[model samples]
Target: MEKPSPSRRAFLGLSAASLAGLSGCLGSLSTETDETPGGNTSDTDPNDGNETDSDNETHEEPTEPPGLPEGGAVMFVYDDGPMEDYTQALPAHRTFDAPATVGIVSEWIGREDYQSSGCMDIEHLEELVDAGWEIASHTSEHTTLGTFELVEDAAPGAERIYPEEIRHGYHRGKTIELTSDEHTFTRAVADYGSDDTGGYIAVDEPIEEACLAGETIIRYPAEKIREAMGDSKHALEGMGFEVETLLAPYDNFDDYSRKFASEYYSGVANARHGKRVNDPEGFDPYRTRRDYFIEYTDRESVKRDLDEIAERGALGVLGAHTFKEEVTEDRIRETLSWVDEREITVMTLREAIARYADR
Candidate 1:
């Protein structure tokens, strides 16, 4: 069932000091306006329908896009809390006095297995928080929050079964539901496996009734989703860091996840993605958009998007996985330079919400 959406005041409850702090970081923005896109203005009078040669020649000066404090804003978000974020991306951003938002996987923090693979530890993340960075939740284990379907069938008491593994949504300890046209069975994942046969999930309890191979597998219930969202925020806050946002694991979430996220987070960075920028008027903090900057991403295309952002005075969000081989420090620095050259404001996702979102 869908849950009630929380109001911004109930969720953020920004105090006078908090607002002052935000204003200190991001100085005053221009008041909201009703200007059209491209800041174009029409000087022609509608009532005076008489057309003249001089009327065609007269042009109105362009103005700032509506709903921003001034010009466009960009937010750089690093996903997965990798060691490279602290080691590589931080220095690049520091060069231009820009702050970034990072989505942390709670279980991966300080875990030897993950640390060995170049994930960030608690100490590394602390340094980021100290440097004006925003720490957001990417969930406890980076579990996929979206639902997928099963590949094979099983009877009651069966503990293991095949699922469409390409989604990579299943994990041990996660509660899941198997739903068919006629019935729904909820079970906790005991283990996850992949081999020559493909990927499968091992449930803790035996299936109560027969389910076919094509049945749908729901990854989370409303209660569990709420638990995951709240627990991740609490875990980070428990570490003395302010966590007011979420970056959905695997950039995958549905209406249920969105609803629960608002209960615990002020905003979500990976809510959507594409070439478009967010409009501040009636902005939905939970549905903010972001574009990926992977190794294969085109530099020119990103520049064009930035151009549009500056021209329209909109909010542009860029997300990246800093740990990847091709996403080097130089590449990150170069992107920051682009935004710098355009004179666009770069702030953390949390700050953007505070500035642009309607409260």
Candidate 2:
């Protein structure tokens, strides 16, 4: 479920504006923050170098070995809402005996509105996991990482949502209102802070420490990226799902966020804006690429993408959402059948990571 790409004119405007704001603060932005393994709590010290080398060592990503024996690996990833899991993907997986991964926004599990006809609740997610589908984090809310505040705490008795405060993407800062102690949603509020420029900054410096100020149009500080990644992982595991992978909203990643992902998750299934054709010999686990299944006009076009993956001996990840009209149940069935006919290896993100990523 990627939002349409910004127009070239709009993108240029944003880039220009961002550069003007980032130029002056570039040097000061590299200060360090202390971090425990999973939580986002931090205390910044401009001179601290204690964690600098360790952080650098942590994000020096290595390429994964080609894990498939014959044809390249093909992972069918269902992104965003979960209703498609029960109504569509599950049946296809069961029919084809395929294993796919579903990336879910953790807080939407049981809510009524978010559980509408096309969306799935917690029980439905559990069913998917029971049927052998890997459930990965699409974050607590599907907030656009570099452009918005990822999540904010909400009081139980108060409004369940605050649409205005939530920014930049489809699911904004969500309120975690779970009733049970077993499902505590931890918010590392202290781990992130806003600069005078209104950019949400990570408390921790990236392993590279290459000041992000003027590097990208938008930047998600290393700490906030960790909070979103760590919180989502904790929430899914708290609810009893085996979580290891992350699916970035809009297939977007900044270098800092990618580094944070490498630190927290076993693998990242989607990175870059769209339809990334990966090179197997030097595939990056943190920035694993994918193409949208719905974007192809015909079966032949999809097969061509698959053929490319096979030719390159790459781990090709394909993304889809059953809720969309273009991504129908019939389409999934057709795709799976085609995959079976092609002898392509279809595995969950977890399965791929176990076989391919450098642990």
Candidate 3:
């Protein structure tokens, strides 16, 4: 991985004047039309009440319209708080005056061992927050929030231990089911423990029947999911960044995760996939969709999605792993340029939700 050179930090100062000029141009464009590009009136009539207002009466200055552009909006979300976000992505976004949101894996920040692998430190993230970016929770340790199959079988009443190390998903007070080819047993986890070998779930009730190890373990118990959500938020907030969104690890989440997300976050990016854009009206903040920018992402397909979002006046959320080889700074710049040409507003996920989503 390439580290940020001193030259890049110097370049940021040089870009400010150009960014100011770009802002001016956009401001002028917004004021040119009485109605916005989406055909909604930008300002309301001040004297429509009587239909016979006196000429001397003072009219209230038209308040600036909402921050979202009528044409459409796009939110750039970078998952995993990697140093590249500060080193590579930030400078490119600065060139375009575009603000983004970054999902942070709480435990990874500032660990020296992880830094070699490109994990960002607290200072790096603080800079992003200062640069108009929003910090979002990716959960502690980047734990998988979705359900997975059990690797071992459990005898009646014994602690259910798995073959693989469990990073998360089990917590006291949450119910889990052990299902096999023939039997399914529901039990509340009385205790949860993990070690170098694997994770174990303790249940007060003895299993009346044995369950096959090859089958699924259903969903992650709810309390543990909440702990992941809440702990990440608290960890980030303790560092003084306001966290109001979640980008579930692996784009994996279910009703249990989504339900818990509402308690901690204002919106969720990568809440679910397969949808390109979110409807501006009545969009579910907890169910917001995202398209990933990956090694095999087709640039043309991305452009088409942006075009559709602009044409429909909907919201588009794009996710990326900035540390990857395929996600170069130049690629990020090119994408931002396309968004700029279409007159689409690039904002943080929180801003997009506040301006567009129902919640």
**RMSD of each candidate relative to the true structure:** 11.2, 19.2, 9.4
lDDT of 2: 0.58
Pairs in steric clash, model 2? 83-120, 202-221
Model 2 residue 131 CA deviation (Å) reads: 2.0
* Rank by lDDT (best first): 1, 3, 2
Superior candidate under lDDT, 1 versus 3: 1
User: For residues 1-359, what per-residue lDDT tens digits would candidate 1 score against the true structure?
Assistant: 01112332222234223653644543433323333222223445567965445744755344222234356888899988878898899999888877789999887787555533668888889888777688888887686665666777777777876776533435666678777788876888888777666787777888878877766565677777777788888888898878888898877766657767777877889787664488866778878888876555788888987887787778888988887778889999998888888878787787678767763
The digit string of per-residue lDDT tens for model 3 on 1-359 reads: 11123442232222222433434444434433322222332234546743434676443322122344677888899988888888889999999878899999999897656534668888888888778788889998686676656677766666655634343334466566655677766777677677564676667677787655666455555676777788989998998887877899878776757667778877788888765588887877788888875455788889899899889878898888887888889999988888888888787777666555532
Superposition error at 46 for model 1 (Å):
48
lDDT of 3: 0.71
Rank by TM-score (best first): 1, 3, 2
Query: Candidate 1 or 2, higher lDDT?
Result: 1
Model 2 misplaced stretches (Cα beyond 4 Å):
1-67, 115-118, 147-216, 220-222
User: Distance (Å) between predicted and true CA of 106, model 2?
Assistant: 0.5
Residue 59 lDDT in candidate 1: 54
Range of the 10 consecutive residues with the lowest summed lDDT in candidate 1: 1-10
Model 2 Cα lDDT, one tens digit per residue, 119-174: 68778888887766788899876755643222333333322222222233232332
**Model 3: number of clashes?**
2
Scored against the true structure, residue 175 in model 1 reaches a CA lDDT of 70
